[model samples]
Target chain A: MAAVLPPQAAPHEFLRARTRWHPLEIVFWLSTLLPFVVVPEYLQLASQIAIAALFAISLDLILGYAGIVSIGHAAYFGLGAYTAGILSKHGIGEPVVLLVLGAIVAGVVGYASSFIIARFRHLALIMITLGICLMFYEAANLAGWLTGGADGLQGIKIGPLAGTFKFDLYGKTAYSYSLIVLFLCFLLARRLTHSPFGLSLRGIRENAVRMPAIGAPSDAHIRKVYTIAAAIAGIAGAVLAQTTSTVSLEVLGFQRSADVLVMLIMGGAGKLYGGILGSIVYMVARDQFSGINPQYWYFWIGLMMVLVVMYLPNGLLGGLEKLTARWRRSPT
Target chain B: MKAFSLCLGGLLAAMFAASGALAQQAVKLGLILPYSGQFADTATQMDNAIKLYVKQHGDSAGGRKIEIIRKDSGGIAPDVAKRLAQELVVRDRVDVLTGLILTPNALAVGDVSAEAKKFTVIMNAATSIITTKSPYMARTSVTTPMLNESLGMWAAKTGVKRVFTMVSDFGPAHDAEEGFIRAFKEAGGQVVGSVRFPVANPDFAAFVQRAKDSNPDGIYAWVPGGVQPAAIGKALSERGIDTKKFRVMGQGELTSDEALQSLGENALGIITVFHYDHNLGNKLNRAFVQAYNADYKRNPDLFSIGGWDGMHLIYEVLKKTGGKTDGEAMIGAAKGMKWESPRGPMMIDPQTRDVVQDVYIRRVERVGGKLVNVDFDKVRNVKDPVKARMK
Candidate 1:
């Protein structure tokens, strides 16, 4: 099979035949390694990036891959946080179990709502999702007996991971825990994207009518993906709750959902890896800008957003990728 | 068969009579609070305090069982207060209603409660104007204007000359800034400048810079919540602004140990005005602080204390009324009623229905690795006759 192929094909064949590393691939791996050694602060920033990446990735799956626009993704995030909090308050200390239960609850709620949500498009979808989020916020307030109400769920003691791994104050445990969860989720997302199921989702995104005609189960596929994305978003929320140990009603606010959407679009949707990069840049920019001018930081962020949307339409990563492609074509 | 029918009739009549007696013996209390959204923390604190009171009192006040029902206001959103009040009255049919965290929320609920002829208790909100506008509303919490005016008076008395004020765009904060400026100016102090920022402002550098450039004798701020003090203090410190150069005064948990840890020593020497502080040397205050710290591992802020006191005050009135749920009876009982509070003797004013309480002027100090109230002085016993600047 190798002999019959061209020289380029031969190289591909050898790489497919054996695990041979590309120079670019090696450099990418090394760059990840370099951060741990040279820029330790980046690791702390990277942990936040990972959590935000998870959030954006969840949104991307629903928005980019499933062709669904959710303006209330924070509903699931907030729900997950409250669930973890409520559960912990009731003496359930296992972090993994709490995380799982939180995700599952959000997923179930998402699945139930997907029927109503899947029928709508654009503005209607946005409004309906926002309505649902507001409903949750109101309900959380009303159900003060369970939710601890506006005072928030305080004095939450997350004892340990599986009753063993204690959470430390300096964010060491939190960073590692978030990193591990993010890595696993990333791998899972990669596998899903490459799978036949993900390709079916892509087909639905391209042409919903065509996919249904071709026996692709478009509505069911969309619903399933939406539910999965919500579950992932719930994981992000659970992680946040574990890290902060205090979940406020602001988690379900429209602003948080908007932030995730912005991050997804800013990172270049559909590529999957863009979410991580976007979250990192966005958070770093926010931190730096706020540090520079606390009161006028929003102005700088708003300005940057305008520039990104107007000039780099596909987002920072997409623009860089395009630049890299051009550079390669022109031999630098 | 006739004898059997008569016995059945007698039994049915007895059951009905028993239920009626039980219903008559119980007093129903309603609490409307923002149990969700941003104000949830305050609501929960109120809820917990009420619950603790109820548990201690055995759900009975003055020989009658007490039935407490609470509804969430959501926030100071349009129509939410009315809806919550309607639910409390129409569904739960509570006799006495209480708990409003924001000024607008208190006003909204106060109207509804008055219309329904229910005794309303304004808990955690510091809207001084509400009591003046509505005779039915009674506030257990300190008023924003009163607190601000006190700060201004204190500053003036301490010989502060030119003052710059910064505050959130909210009504309470706006009122605080305005009231302080007015009082400070009245006390022969010159107003340098004033700026209002949005509540969700994450950065305070511009405001700090503006204040610095103005070169005021003191800077007065009215920013609340846990985040504001830290953010403002850190920014001020980073800008090399000294607290000694200006008198920083406001309502916040920012000067607390938890906030100081995040803000560092920048919070030190900051003067703050409030009705209650953990350092107050009253029996109730000492017990409350000790119990709360033992329970929550954190010092109770004014919000928590206010919540606890609001519940206690309501309970005291209910107990005095002999389980009468009538609005008139409860109102009469509440007026001129004195209670031993965390801030000492608290009396409900007969006319305005506002609490006549002592206000404290505290300077923030780092004690045992925590920012706490040190060098506190009881500046004045604020009474209702002072007349809140509402109109």
Candidate 2:
């Protein structure tokens, strides 16, 4: 009804309308490139934000789109990071290959874990996810020879992208590499979320009890989206490990899982742009606040998250959308 | 949307860019430390020492005023440490990097230091292989093996022949065990037994009882400076292990203030070895203690001495290079640079660029109703055993 589609409109035409790019979305992504010309010094921070945004989007898939809460998303993230780190340490230093392998490893692990995840919802789902992350953290700590234990995995040598672009101190290569990967993954996520499969996922999220009667099994849908989200998160973690050239136990930390969730909530769930915008705000706030008071910067980040959730309940992006809807309630 | 995107992008780019638009005349030093977390106290002590050094030395070396940029790492977040290092080198254009506490954080910064060819002085990270990670790095902090190896040999020399070893399982703890066993065996001592416990949130009751049951001449254990010391001390006492007869030896933490508070009268005869001690009877140390007390109003620890010497080395190297901040020139001058520190005479080992200092053997005894580790003997000019054996 909202789309004003004719009763006889073809399914393909409806799909096309749903997949059409918003002007703001296009402009927003394009603006990420401006840092290359304007602020070369901040390319490092830019790349980190891009990776975090990608991570947040991955969480949005399972948590926002599928209505599956995950508190231990870092399991996939850490797996992907450690995969890249371990491979690079063992002489498999190609960046592109490492990224692919990281995704594959995380995807496989996510698929294996989805059996347990698909059986639970809400409180149970959160507990299982958290427990899995704790297991990974302990395993990494116990296997000091492989993961470097408390000292962290050192001497991770990520080879140049395309055999030409080196990871420089200025972070020009790292930013470009991260941005490209993020865009490719973002496009895939966008396509997947626009299909009939995505509609089924929303149906399952809206009413799991009625979804099975309509031939959309909630478990299957959750499994598929959770795996997809894990793979995307894996890509993000790979980007981070490759760019930084070091991986620590903190990659598997609960703090990371919580922070990303906070990001998604602040930006608005189910809105792709919301996830991206939230990450930018959170990361930039951290960079700025830490400069003023490095000792208590976390306090500022916490306050900002609280303010966003309080004033804009559904999130900043939701609030913005509502305000825009009111401003142009009818076409001129 | 384009307008908003442009505005957001412009604002961020402007902010980060504005930070870099500072005057470049001063020699900038970027201090990356865990300033607000579990290790905050250690950061505070080390930071205070760096400040005190600048205050005493008038903050200028070789006609260049020192500009400090402090960054809080929070905790053992290696990625943050690495990113901060990169930012310091590229954005802040810092001449030297210092004040890293955790060994892992230092390891994370090693790549940046190597790539940028930035001279880095590690003030407190104690892993022996840290200096090996980057040629541009030099450590003023004592390595794990430096203290543990000295303790092992000293214990053997002073007639404790059989020993049981226990350490919290981690990188430095492994180093501690390896150093002690190798030195003890080399000095003609027998290791009766050994055990490793979890590094985080470990209960020492079972481990302590097991070590006590081994019935060795002494027990050599290494746990980091935290609640672990007090916990282990309580465990040892609860197991009825007399500290007077059967010696409990370690790398400083065994007789720390926390251990004394927990162990009580049982802490009377426990022996430990370390590079720096507040109880050292030298005039320079006394002055350092006095000045530190006047300024910070707290007793300076081993971490403080490391930062003090780090700042001193930075100052001396800058003076020698006449304000050149290049990695090669600074390191060249820093190597084998000997000075009389508050702790004692120390030098930077020319080949390895690691600290070579006196390791003191101290016994906990009550003096004027206060529990203190009084210095009984010393090992002069001890080098990190790992690097010494390697090269």
Q: Give the best candidate by TM-score.
A: 2
Best by DockQ: 2
Q: Which 10 consecutive positions of candidate 1 chain B have the poorest summed lDDT?
A: B75-84
lDDT of 2 by residue, A1-332 (tens): 02547869998788888788877778888899999889878899999999999999999998888888989999899999999999999898899999999999999989889988888878998899999999999899889889998888976988988887788777888899999998999898889888988878888778888989988888888888888899889889999999988888889989899989988899898877778888988888887888778777888887887788789998889989878888888676
Candidate 2 docking DockQ: 0.57
DockQ of 1: 0.02
For residue B389, model 2's alpha carbon misses the true position, in angstroms, by 1.6
| Cα lDDT of model 1 by residue, B1-391, tens digit | 3674486479648854764577555567776766655667666666666665565557766666777666555555323454456546644556777777765556555555665667888777775656654555677878766777777877887889998888876545766787788778888889889998877788999999999899887888877667887899887887778875567877544466567677677888888877777787778778877877666666667667676777777778877876665678788888888887877778888877888887788888877876677746765667632364332
Interface RMSD of each: 19.1, 1.3
**TM-score of chain A, every prediction, order shown:** 0.88, 0.96
Tens-digit per-residue lDDT, A164-274, candidate 1 = 565532234556677778778877776676566777888887888898888889889888998998898889988777764656566777878988888888888876767
Task: Provide the lowest-lDDT 10-residue window in model 2 chain B.
Answer: B15-24
